[model samples]
Target: MKKLRLAVAVIAAAALCPFMAKAQIDLGAKAGLSIPNLTSGSSSNPINSGWSSRLGLDAGIHAEFHLTKRFSIQPEIRYSSQGGKKDGNQGFAPTPEMAGAFQQMGQPVPPYLYATYKSEAKFNYLMVPVLAKYHFGFSPKWDLYVAAGPFVSFLLNGKNETSGTSQIFADDAHKQPLPFPAVDFTRDQDIKNDLKKANFGISGHVGLAYHLNGRSAIFIEGGGNYGFVKIQKDAKNGENNTGAGVVVLGYSYRIKNK
Candidate 1:
């Protein structure tokens, strides 16, 4: 009976050792910069012009669950700012057919006229991401990690602003400006209703962490998020996808095992 009890105790202690060594939980806050842009679908209207990346912000809190010595899962809730800029020249000249029609009417075809338009779109979102992470120990106080995950975001607000200058020339040869005053205008509008309320996407990250102590650490990371869903709802032609690259700095605290 004594021998059997000794064997049982040994086996139980062996089973519990791995769990006690590997299981840990952490919570943290993070904030950073993001470069956001839109990817337009093939069927999208060319008149809308192309998009360029815009600078934005991201901030959030995250909870990490360590399942083993080298593997973990982190879930975060973050507020993100995203959007893009569009700048181009539109309605520059009359088409060949239009010019012919003017000649037939005996109306003198006025010199070519053109307008330059510059516009920006901004969006705010509440985003949730669940990431599976793999860690590698680089030293006693430093660690390197990579993570991949999926995320969903809800749009909180959106705005669009546009400004333009229209120029008229005295002749088609492009020399001499018309005496008429140049037209300049600016407009701003809320566009929440024009955009989809929710977006779904995949995200990936790579980062390095420095442990301040057994219970605390600081980390820096760079990653990107890509959306599969269209950003707009009432699109006449194609889809607009959202994508962003992010850089962040964060602090974390490990909860003591009771």
Candidate 2:
């Protein structure tokens, strides 16, 4: 994590080097919705596979330095909400008792225990993205721009929350039941320890801005982010990647150079 952080800082500093002396710098803040999902790379691992998008909060503050009339460099510190959801019947790892019962009968243990419930894996991350932005001025008051860059994220928190009342079964066919009592899947489990702390990814944006004055502009944009690495520390948990689609509204103001 320290190495990742150092790399991001060095990259941002390198991007800012040439423009510092003359470019106009703008400071801004934005807030919006994040629609995040986990990509379950394999179907065979039922315990950590099959998930859908979940709503989350995305917000950030950034500094943009204009390098030319149409180009700029922007580096940001952002908070991202990520993860995915699964509903209905899902698989759980078998317990010791479950494995022993199958063993006593001279039967091989099944890979998972079947349960009908809902699971939402929630994650929070602090991200930094250094971007190259280009703007098209259509009018004195309006401009359209797009940006793309690589980002690094440090995980702040992660939790597995489950909720439902479902029968536990030793097989997907529901013919075999475990001896455990009625199962209740309703609790938040801290999963941060099971995940790596830093992630590397890509993020991009496309939007339009309306200049409110010579020093300020208001804009709305939509963007997306995808992490290149798997999220789990142990391969047995399943290989899942993180990503999100986002929409936000923001305002930027140039600082006076006096």
Candidate 3:
């Protein structure tokens, strides 16, 4: 009877070990700024100009599972706003042969014309990242950590806005010119159909946290996300991948292990 009772107690403790381990989970929320850009493809040029970085927002919730004294696995779900901007000037002039042809056709050619163009593309995505983190202790109250892993993002919405001004000149020699109306216009359109629905990337970050006690702390982190998959749906239009640099400030709380 004594041997049976001991055996039953051991079995009950063994069965509770997994559940007890999971009670050590930590939860946190983070919010910050992200600078995002679309990496231009080989086809990007003066005509189909490349993209530049734009400012956006990043916010997320994460769960961290401690595996050891100095290591943890963190999984996060985030809302990220990302995109790029393009701004520049382009000029066009009539060739001599073309000018002559226009004259023969009773249509005088404009000697010179130039346009200043500006455009921005905005994309919103839901992203999930699973990271492996290693912690380094500077003191009992301060710790530093570095994490890296893979992330998958789903595009929620996208838009593109363009504005430009074009001025036409009568002739290079005659700067005073005719009464040709300058063209100025702005257009905003939905671009979801033109972009890929999903994107996959590698993300990594380094941060420092200060422990207030055994349960809570504050942290700051800087990280970069680089997408390997193209974000454009049609490859023929040229490849454009997502890239972002982010900085976040957050607080975390550890749940007591049962």
Which prediction has the highest lDDT against the true structure? 2
Clashing pairs in 3: none
Runs in model 2 lying further than 4 Å from the true structure: 1-16, 100-107, 173-180, 256-258
Residue pairs in clash, model 1: none
Model 3 ranges with Cα > 4 A deviation: 1-23, 41-49, 90-114, 167-182
Model 2 C-alpha RMSD to native: 2.9
Model 2 collision count: 0
lDDT of 3 by residue, 1-258 (tens): 979967985896587557547647889999999999888656433323457899999999998878677887788999888888878653334447647756787885754444556778899999999888999987999999999998989999999887886554443333643344565637897989988898888888999999999889999999989888877776544467788999999999987543
Worst 10 residues of 2 by lDDT: 40-49
Candidate 1 deviation (Cα RMSD):
11.9
**Judged by lDDT against the true structure, how good is candidate 2?**
0.89
Name the lDDT of candidate 3: 0.78
- Candidate 1: residue 70 lDDT (0-100): 90
